[model samples]
Target: MFPSKSDFLLRLTTCLLSWVSALILVLIVWFLFVESELVWREVGVLRFLTDDRWSPSGDFSSAQFGLFPMIVASLLLAVGSILLAAPIGVGAALFAAYYAPRGVRQIFPRIVELLGGIPSVVYGLWGLVVLVPLISAYHPPGTSLLAGIVVVAIMILPTVALLTLSTFQQLPTSLIHSAAALGIAPTGIVRSVILPASRSGIMTAVLLAVTRAVGETMAVLMVCGNVIQAPSSPFSPVRTLTANIALEMAYAMQSHRSALFATGLALMLVVTLLVLIAEQQRGKAGHV
Candidate 1:
């Protein structure tokens, strides 16, 4: 009877907690909509989206608020960093899961897990102190879209590596053994058997990593130079939507404050889309 009561309580607790989480998500969406409504009403969604600059001089009447540059920067930063990190992260995962020696297999993944544990601010600080200077040596000012991409790639690398490693580890050992028994080289076995088996899993890792890279703020803000312009080159100074909101939200008033909320709303939608994509990949992986 006591065990039955305890089980009921546990089940009830989990159900309540699940509802609470759902409530929080609904609340967040409600809050963003409520706060952003003013901007949508005032700016008209199309004009707000298509305007080409973000400059605030004396007041709201004289100021121009454009999100295009920030939007472009954020996309470039997210895509470029994912492109740079995906291959390296996948390679590391393959090495750790399949090719590493007995001793290295234990140590390598622990190092990667530890890297993921480090705080974003610490990465930002390191970039500010170390990486920015290194880039500056090549050019007059070091902070640019390139710096943000490098920092974000490094930040998301562990995420990609860890997930891919888990995916690789889950592959059926019997299949690998059969391929090897057929006189296939290690490289050929990986390319033909393991990679095809793990395609959906690898994509899930990449989409999840891109989600993180898109939402990253502190490190990007510190190193991205915060210039509101479309990035013409990797070296061009740029500002992301996250960086823009972080830089201005504090002192902003009225329309400006609502604009920040609108930016947050945009970010939320983008993240939600990425999350949906990742979940679809995860479902495919499960079926595979």
Candidate 2:
């Protein structure tokens, strides 16, 4: 009876903890929405979204806060990171799930797991010392968009690969066998059967990669030039929302602080929408 009561109390405590966490998330959302009202009043809704200029330092009473440049930069970095990470991640996942010999699989997955455990700061350090120099030869500037893309790609690869590996492991062997039963070649089976069955998981991995890339600060800041200008090419230095926030959050004041918070609100909004879309896709996969 004592053990049962203890277990009940433990479960109840866990439930409370979960609710507390959820409440915190809700409060964060509310705070962002509340702070964004200042920008709305200053720039108005339409101009804030449509205008390209960000003249928060200007003499105009209502300083411009168009997030378009930051939005573009974030998307560019995330998209580039995803492109660089996804293929190798998916390939490694497939190999680990289907093709790896037992000895190789055991060691390789352990290595990947270790990669995930490393701190983001270490990645930034490595990018600063190694990746930045390597890219500068071709880029002509070490801290270019390509450097940011490559570093972010490497940082998120382990996450995507591990998630995909888990997804493939959860799949039934009979699914693979069924494709073989249809007289399909192994490669064809992987393409038509495994790939189709794993579409939701792949999309989830891609979304995760995008989220990490968008939110990543240290490695990106280390490699990206931190220039506010729009990137003309992968070789150009670019600044992202996360980078800007990291670089300026220290001394930002008044409207500047509010604008930074506004950027955070925008980033969270985009991430939340993407997560919802991924969830919907996951539901569709269930129906399939």
Among the numbered candidates, top lDDT falls to 1
Model 1 regions more than 4 Å off: 1-14, 56-62, 286-288
Worst 10 residues of 2 by lDDT: 279-288
Q: Tens digits of per-residue lDDT for model 1 on 99-217? A: 98999999998999999989999999998899989998997488989999999999999999999999888888988999999999999998998888888889999999999999999
Candidate 2 lDDT, 120-224, residue by residue in tens: 888988988898888887667888888888888988999889988887877788888887998999999888888888888888878877888889988888888
Candidate 2 Cα outliers beyond 4 Å, as residue runs = 1-15, 49-62, 286-288
All candidates: TM-score: 0.93, 0.89
lDDT of each: 0.89, 0.81
Global local distance difference test of model 1: 0.89
